[model samples]
Target: MRIQLTFVLLFVAAVLQAQDIKISTKDNDLKLAALPYYSYGKGLGITSADSLFQLNIRFRMQNRIGFIKNEGEDDAYDGQIRRLRLRFDGYVGNPHFLYVLQLSFAPGDVGEIHDGENINIIRDAAVIYRPNRNWSFTFGQTKLPGNRQRVNSSGALQLTDRSINNAKFNIDRDFGLQAYYLNEKKDQFSYNLKAAVTTGEGRNWTKSPDNGVALTGKIELFPLGSFTKDGSNFEGDLAREKTPKLLFSGAYHQNNNARRTQGQLGDDLYQQKTLRSFFADAMFKYNGWAAMATYMSRASHNPVAVDPLDPTLTNYAYVGHGMDYQLSYTFPTNYEIIGRFSTQKANKDIKAFTPDTNEYTLGVTKYLWEHAFKLQAEFTYDRLSFNDGSTKNNWYVRFQIEIGI
Candidate 1:
């Protein structure tokens, strides 16, 4: 296994040690609470009397119904739970140390079935160690610092779902070590740097294939200082900033000897190939308006892989480029209208397997309680162009509702 049996044990002092004990443990000072406290969107929270240990419980569900129409095919419709997740975050011992655990309960949220099997429901199991105000380190499984769209939480998006560009090139999540540093100053130049080393396999990686691993680096700079209300992580200009705010970012990632068609994901490749990706994106918000753009490109020295033992067996690494742009405006009534355009091109080497595509989507959302509880509806026009100069088109219509504590 990639972890090589490297195990970390966290002995949390639960709030059940009120039996003649001053504290559960030296590092912890939590006790049973008579009642849990509630917040608008923060869910249920509790803090120890001594304020050493704390916890928050939150969960959300996305119920959706959709219909699709193809140019020359019969119409199809389906309804199901899109996402169901439970999240817990709190400080354990040291205030600088934090723990986060998230689990996926929706069938689709778990993972795509590979060989009739899915991964563990666990989505995030990580700990953050912030030694100082400017630095933090993370260990365990979590989302990677890839494109801003990929790094952003799904619950924070204005769109019914992420753009097609993210589905194609996002590195997603893995088990690894990540380091982050930030130098921020309001009304001044602010920047952040991120780096990670991960086993180039999914969290369920069984064997550590030779030297297979993924390396990533990212940097973001805010020329005019940070956006109010942590605008960078959520879509749209909910904060309605009076002054303009801008952010620019770039990232690079490399997966050596990857065993999947899409590096860290997709059908298990019987062969391996080193894959590289380049990314650049920017965000801007001003006067109740917001816009964001992203670009990604992927390449491999040997896009095609062939088994040494079986000459006829082969696999091809997904290689191509994708780009998307999003714009939205929030009204004083807590309503928002959003539009997006995205395109993807598969390298000629693998064009037959994938296609060059274009997409346009328009959506409207009503914030019942910010992102925690909302109603959304969208329509999409999709076009697929093949290497043979042939094209196909489809249309999608959907509605969704999200609610949580």
Candidate 2:
């Protein structure tokens, strides 16, 4: 409770600081308006008088606490600042060219050290060029078009975090180049195609690479029509679309000569291997109801790498399959109820090393002002079945507070 109060007080201090920080010789500050009177999610939108360039600045923080009770083991607790980030997004030269820069401040957001260092503060630094309404090209470090759950921004999630499938098989972020095309016809039909080529190494790997590369492609189709306000990106039907909206998406990724355990992520591998990943997901929303289902799988010629001379030294990729499904309903009063079932199974390659698991979660959220300010709580029943026929059960309770602008 003390930590939570401190977080809120710190946010208030930040708001005051933002209102006083000048950005130009004219003494203009980043504040769009004085605190207690501000827009929802617009952040500090700054535009040049000539309209030649623009900038939008936003910051967000996620504070979390969780308690866990393991079967036949000691009860434990986990709490921390899950995510704290600041982002700057806008256009330069003209509206056709755009750029975004994001930075992470929380310890957990930086991820575990890889390639020997822990200073992974920068999250995204990308420049995009949109030639027209239908086409866009992106360059520099950013997220890959691998999975729907991974592509969605973390601040707009329905649950405490993404599914287990994403943890193992997601082709996260990298230094990459991407091309995208979108075609839509009002509330009728729409489709989007995205493709990217990135260095096999994940983000913040400053060391030299082995000339490896990862290729990712994804396509989404809206059969019944598109969601209002690009609602597909958000987890639930916050906008409460009057009409029905549905989206089906598929993605494929291949990492050649990957040097990490989880293909662009994880600790370095003793021997590099080729990994391929596949994903399929569906999202539906209508009249305050929302549902999502996803499938993920990965295959490798030889997922396990063994040192011939040193049998004790072995490393392998987490090659397996998993599925996740979620359902939610929101009331007119801005309160929501959510339920999810997630499961994952290991393949023959690393089945003995990792366990097969199932998880059931129930959650509730209160949105004071959309997702800009919300309180969330959840409970999860976790069961793990090992390859050796042993099973372990646990229970987890969590609560979170999110504040953003």
Candidate 3:
């Protein structure tokens, strides 16, 4: 009881200090306001807090209605609330530290009801310290700074999801620390680069040993130019000007665990795995049409099933690869027609997971009711091939209607 009371007092003391600092800034500083903000889609956010020390909240809800044909049955269903996210983002005054806490409720509930109620932590909490505009350091439970395609959030991506290699490398999310740097006005070109050190296990923060750290980095190119006749703007423009952008990213992850010994085998074996990946993506927009293509490959050590004859001997080898593309055309009425193709190929020896898949999709999306609501539909064809000569094909049609206020 005494320890709990002491900890509460410490927290109160910290809050008092923070309040004092915020009061000093308000006396002779710019007052920042928060609340009652509007959002149109996702990009280029403009929002602020009531004061230097304040809390910000953002919420989103999504639904997926589709029909899928599994091995035996055709399941036609409308899945609602596919994603429900509530996020909190803000900063402290004196420390000047930015923080984000994102909670995904639907996925958590789905995992519990679907996967035997396995205990897991699906939410992410991160704290970033920006010493300057050019450099920032982040430490927390979050996604690693890997390839551009993987780093890009689903809310901003142009496709349904990431490619096969990305899913295979499973760099989805991990607990780690990152250092990011950007040179926005370097001559005629600008670039964004980030480096991260993390546990190789994807989203397995508890199982990670302290021996190894995964290293990843990305580099993107930006074109510079002007559109307006007046020479008033010095920073340049993005929406008015038209240009192409390219991104290249790569990562290397390795881990060495302590050796294990068996009494009957009279031998020792160490579990060590190494992975390397390379990715390239390009996006171009001309007139009312846009094009995007991405390619990535991964090489990693995967162990074969254990041998009953000799428990001491094990089999391990390396391989995987994948690619995807998107072509979209928008009409004057803001309606879009999109076609996408993706393919994957992987090593023959690995069977626990294979990357040999092909998919083709055609989609159309239009805005209605003063462009405040979106109606979209798509048809997809997927083909899967296994190393054991087992093949499967599937067709699905999806329809979605989203509205914002």
Per-candidate TM vs. native? 0.88, 0.88, 0.71
**Residue by residue across 54-95, what tens digits does model 3's lDDT show?**
455666555567887755466666556555666666666633
- Alpha-carbon runs more than 4 Å astray in model 2: 1-40, 112-115, 307-309
Best by the lDDT measure:
2
Task: Give stretches of model 1 more than 4 Å off.
Answer: 1-40, 112-118, 207-209, 307-310
Cα displacement (angstroms), candidate 2, residue 332, comes to 0.6
The lowest-lDDT stretch of 10 consecutive residues in candidate 1 is 29-38
Q: After superposition, how far is residue 224 of candidate 2 from its true place, in Å?
A: 1.8
In candidate 1, the residue pairs with backbone N, CA or C atoms under 3 Å apart (3 or more residues apart, or in different chains) clash, namely none
lDDT by residue (23-69, candidate 2, tens digit) is 33222121111011122466888889997788989998999999989
The backbone clash count of each candidate, in order, is: 0, 0, 2
TM-score of structure candidate 3: 0.71
lDDT of 1 by residue, 233-274 (tens): 788888898889999999999988888888777876777888
